[model samples]
Target: MGTTTLIAVAATGLMAGVFFAFSVAVMPGLADLTPEHARGAMRRINARIQNPVFLLVFLGTAVVCGIEVFQGRIAGGLLYVLGCFVLTMAVNVPMNNRLERTDDAYWPEYLRKWTLWNHVRAACCLASTVTLLLGL
Candidate 1:
């Protein structure tokens, strides 16, 4: 694979790991807490996760994947962009925004829905990685 495709594979894999970790570990751990505590912790996490490193990997992966689409790795690139990136922007980020405005009462629904979408994101990234690798 060329450098850009390699980067897309790595970035997508990294993103997949991140979402998987959150789905399997972070969210579950938070579920053990009381709703208020869970909500507070998640709110803080949502805030903190917006930093440079995460944004670089998250947004950068989309950019790399977009480039790959033009470069002919269409399946993998589109999967990441549409399944992961678009879903994130269209669903997860909006949910996060609503979460910021929500009280603890909304936490249960938020947790359920957010984790569900996160699983989808993880799967998309994983599939994107595998598809890119296969195309090579």
Candidate 2:
């Protein structure tokens, strides 16, 4: 229960909540809209989510997890970094960038794939939180 690990737990939990909300509420709400409307809304959401507060939680949590990994909180920290952070960097972000560049025709596939991967991220964040708490 060091301060760093506590921070890791809080951050990861927050991330999990965000992803979970998207999975359960946001995406579903978007899906209800027409493709053009959904695409536009998602694009705006993607842009808006890059703000400072979100970045501080997202990137800052990854940085903290990296530190935790080296400090021997390997299981939880590594899971957060690799599963959530790296996965977002590798998969979700690319899809989002593609969504921004492409037209509404891409919305169906994008919604499906993005939501699927987001579920993964949410699970990872939750698991990371639990493991980190257990490690404490």
Candidate 3:
């Protein structure tokens, strides 16, 4: 791989790692809080972490992944990344907009949907990562 391809892959890997750690591990633990005070604190953390800036960064990283795929016949990776990008723009963004407008009380339901979409995105990201790694 060229320098650009290596850089892109590294960036994608880093983004995916951070996202998996936070979304799958940290956020779930935070969401499991029991007491009202603790729940409130967790909610605040989630809100702060899932802000627009974070989404933009995530989207941008996916774009870089798409670009990296162009270095070779990484059609599968490109397709997966494109699918993820479309889903984020079409579904995730709107849901997040609703989340931002709503109260914390409605977060459980939103979080459920968010988690589902996030899992889909993570799968696609992983597929792309593996494809790139295998030089497929």
Candidate 4:
């Protein structure tokens, strides 16, 4: 694989791992917590996750994937771009934003809904990674 493709693959894998972790482990653990604690923790994590490195991998994958599609070479990356980036901007981030406005009383429903979307995100990203590898 070319260097750029490798980087895109790595970034997609990272994004997939993150979503899967939340879907499989993080939310389950948080589900066991008191509503107040769970909300607070989720809020903190959502805020903290918007750092430079995460942004690099998250946005970087989209950018590279777009390049791949535009170049007509290795179009597999478009999947990651659409699934992780577009869907996130369309759905997950909006929900998270609404989640921030909510009180603990609403956390349970938010958690359930958010995690359900997260499962989609996880599947998409994981599929993106495999698709990219196949393109190689």
Candidate 5:
């Protein structure tokens, strides 16, 4: 595999691990907490997850994978990038912004829906990793 391809697949795999962690551990743990406490924790987490290193991995993988797609392999790069990344920016971020304004009473529904979509993103990231591995 080329350096870019190796980098893309590795970054995507890392992202899948992050998603899986959230789905299996983070979200489930949050479910047991009081809504106000959960919201506070999630708000901090949301901010922390946006650090420079994460962005580089997330977006850098997408950019490299996209190049591979155009080079002829149908790498399924855009599936994860557009599906997971775009959905996060569109649906998840909006919901998170709403949560900041919303009452603690609504946290349950928000958590349920957010986690549901997160699972979808996780699946997409995993799929991206697997397909890229095969392509390599």
Candidate 6:
């Protein structure tokens, strides 16, 4: 049961993280190339997609992983989930919140940090995928 739950949570995290990574990285570059109105529309779309409910779902997956790990199955998978949690809390969330407050003047710099954190997230997601494959 624990292993099953861990795998399920990890899979969800993998998908969300991968999607977020692409959005923060490739999507922004594409947005930059787009016209101003298109960029504004894209930003609005992204904001809607990244609402608190979405964040809760993402965070809830990590919490579920912890519960599964406490049951003594999928230790490595739990580790990866924990890593993702740490990165999210320690880096991504704070940076994102800060970026939200800053004006367009600092957007480029914030975008760089956003991309870097996304890369970190991608690594953690890959780690989770590996853990699932290894069934550790």
Candidate 2's residue-wise lDDT over 1-136, tens digit each?
9999999999999999999999999999999999999999999999999999999999999999998898888999988999999999999999999999999999999999999999999999999999999983
- Stretches of candidate 3 exceeding 4 Å from the true structure: 34-60, 76-80
Candidate 1 C-alpha lDDT tens digits along 65-136: 999999999999999999999999999999999988978899999999999999999999999999999982
Descending-lDDT candidate ranking: 2, 1, 4, 5, 3, 6
lDDT of each: 0.95, 0.96, 0.64, 0.85, 0.83, 0.61
Candidate 3 per-residue lDDT, tens place, 11-92, comes to: 5565566657757886587567643543466556657867677766676666666666676737534745664677777876
Q: Clashing residue pairs in candidate 3, if any?
A: none
Off by over 4 Å in 5: none
lDDT at 68 for candidate 5?
65
- The candidate, 4 or 6, that scores higher on TM-score is 4
Window of ten residues with lowest summed lDDT in model 3 = 34-43
Tens-digit per-residue lDDT, 1-136, candidate 4: 7777788778888999999999999999999999999999999999999999999888988988887776654547777877779889998899789889988888988899989988888888888778778873
Residue 26 of model 1, lDDT score: 100
Q: Give the better candidate number (5 or 6) by lDDT.
A: 5
Q: Candidate 1: give the clashing pairs.
A: none
Candidate 5 per-residue C-alpha lDDT over 13-61 given as tens digits, one digit per residue, 9 for 90 to 100 = 8888998899999999999999999988898898898899998887787
Q: What C-alpha lDDT, on a 0 to 100 scale, does residue 80 get in candidate 1?
A: 97
Task: Tell me the lDDT of model 5 at 85.
Answer: 79
TM-score winner, 2 or 4: 2
**Model 5, C-alpha of 74: deviation from truth (Å):** 2.2
After superposition on all C-alphas, the RMSD of every candidate to the true structure, in Å, is: 0.9, 0.9, 3.6, 1.5, 1.4, 3.8
